[model samples]
Target: MKTRQFFASLAAASILLAVPAFAADSAQAFVDKAAIGGKFEVDSSQIALGKVQDQSIKDFAQMMIRDHGAANAKLATVAGEQKLKVPSALDAQHQGDLDKLKNAQAPIDPAYVDMQRKAHADAVKLFETYASGGDNAGLKTFAQQTVDTLKTHQQMIEKIAAGQDAITGATTPAVKTDNTPNAAALVPGANSFTEAQAKSRIEGAGYTNVSKLTKDDQGIWRGHATKAGEGLAVGLDYQGNVVAASK
Candidate 1:
């Protein structure tokens, strides 16, 4: 039993451990890992945007591009202000992941989503550790702010993977959730997002022709919409949950 447990631990540590490993050592190490990992998210999502067919995956990729691009820029500013150099390129491991995605054949959505899930897990570990125990105040604060988005990314990828696996068919995506940098209750409540902002967020989740949007007393925005050639009853809750049900 001890031998089996020991090997299991080693095997688990062997996968995607390098990224988080860097962040555990020092402030400089954390910065390097964070920057390189952010680069990987943006670059790979750009590839997915071109190749992946599922609208959910495409929407997820778009979110990743926008969020990580912004996050990377924020990290750059923080790094410069703190006099730390952010790495401009993906390291060996991440570059290898990107190359694999590029070479993957049609129906790349599964591969892309799976890669995102694992990558985001590692990223969450790196950021959470740095946020709580890093050596620098500025970098720690950045990590603190960025980790939640990483977690939401992980959750999104997981749903994508599960949605794809629901059938032995093509990689159809699952539920589309908005991780739009905010802290609102999962249940409806006084929504802070404006009506236009709500529509934009819902549209960003891949719904189109959105109309009849009205906020209920519960603070959930309910509306009509279309997705993947099918009309859906769409609603946006305070927590950025853009749910689509059959009409």
Candidate 2:
């Protein structure tokens, strides 16, 4: 009788220990999702390295390639130790995102920024969930260590998208300041902002309906924008100064 009761209790304990193994995000699920997300970062950034014109976006793409490439390798190593499979390519959904980058609707910079925003948000959530409640000890540790890097990336991209994009925490204004009384005098220098970035900068300065943006010789982006229910000419300098256009 005593032996039977002991065996019963032991079985119950074993069952309790096995419950976490069937967690919502299983070990292999983490491996798959992480692999897919990492692949997307590497592949999309690879495309950006070749096609993107924005210097900030270009620098970010380079970082994604270097960082995600290393993370992928480390994940593969960990997955191998756990006898899990690492996917070599992006999943169907991520492949679609990559396709958009490959053949974007023009001004691929915005597309890339949009894609990274979504991707890093997903990655940060995934890593946070797994870090705290994952089935595998190794993956949980990896997720914990990686979550901070992903969050930093998220902040960086937000700054870039917001047009406050100098990695060094500063942007130079164009030689031509916007809102000068003489629209023709808007000085141009070297405008590196894509249309999307220029629009974002203008919008960030509280303008709306920015349209017909064109870069002139002084590296100034001149466009029609509305402020306070007033339609006026707006311009952005290389340094990101947005001012009303002289009528």
Candidate 3:
């Protein structure tokens, strides 16, 4: 009995020691993949800004550049603190995505929008998985916070795709616009507050539980807020406008 109990204790000790190693590995893998994805988004969007004739597509590409660039910076800081080595170059798969975007034929708006939708959809899944069950605590928090931003990007890209389909009479499924109170459109450039200022403004506007706030290049701040026991998609634009959309 003593021998069996001793062996069981040893096994438990081994498992305990292995947990951090597994977490570190998970964190490293996440950082590597996220770095590559951010680079791909920014680079491809830059290309699209120059190539796509559609104004809305240009706007979406600019938003991607700004948002992904900020996210990459944050991830880099976290990776450095965690002693993880994030890859400096795109992986082969992401490289192929970039190549595809660059070589896509005329009417590049639709193709570009399609790619953005798919990429963002994948990104949402990746972030959601990490947020829910990742071994690393800090990165898990980061993932959880970032998931909202990725979801917003996905929704915007889907809207663009649907609009494009409408214009071209394509059979692509149309996104139904919700008429709920939280479904208000973002008024870009409607506010001039920096992110910090936007937070203050949001608090002043009687929003509680404000978090996950992010500001795009157009000075639009997006995240969650609550008022009257209802969740809202709240934003402050560059033109100093504060607006809330129903969730």
Candidate 4:
């Protein structure tokens, strides 16, 4: 009976010793799967950003490659010790993004900033979801760590898009000359036409048949009107509240 109890005790000790190996193997398997997924994701981004013309995007892509690639290598070492396998390629959605970015290599429109912003936004969402919901503890931890990085990237990309919009919106047409005075060169002084000066000058002028108005290359205000039988050009001095009459 003593021998029988001794045998059972040894069996339990063996099982306890084996438990750690099993756990280690399971942890490695989970980490391996995650690394595989991350590898493809990083590869897609590297190729996509490589085609971008923006220096910022290109620099960021280089960073992603270095960081994620290092993490993948580390994971491979861990997985190998536990006899686990990592996936060798990306999924369909990532492939699609890669293709789109590649095709946009030519010209590389500034509007591509919008595409980058959206992509980062989606990535943040995906990483956050997986980090919280993944079955493996190691994978979940890795994902959680990755989520912070992805969210930061999303914010940066959004700022880039906003900058592009501001640049586009602030653009104004170049001023063109049409016998109009170069009003842009005029310095505002005591004799300059203020809002009140302009309003008073136009109101008091006995101008008739005024069809078009413009400034001249010499900082003179010119107006066109049908006078008598032909178009006559007249200059007005809003600063003096008077018309210089056609000269």
TM-score of each: 0.59, 0.65, 0.65, 0.47
Q: How many clashing residue pairs appear in each of the predictions shown?
A: 0, 10, 11, 8
Query: lDDT per residue, candidate 2, 60-163, as tens digits?
Result: 99999999999999999998988888988788899998998888754477789889999999999999999988878888898988899999999988867666
lDDT of 3 by residue, 1-247 (tens): 9999999999999999999898898889999888888888899899898877656677789999999999999988888888898798988887887888788774477668877888898889999999999887778888998999999999888866654553343111122335232213445554544466566556645578888898766657788888778777776554334567667
Q: What are the RMSDs of all candidates, in order?
A: 13.5, 9.1, 15.1, 16.4
lDDT of 4 by residue, 73-107 (tens): 76676456555667676557655666675766453
For model 3 the local lDDT of residue 192 reads: 42
Full-model lDDT for every candidate: 0.78, 0.78, 0.75, 0.53
After superposition, which runs of candidate 4 have C-alpha atoms over 4 Å from their true positions?
1-41, 48-50, 74-84, 109-115, 170-247
Residue 6 lDDT (model 4): 100
Q: Which window of ten consecutive residues has the lowest lDDT sum in model 2?
A: 166-175
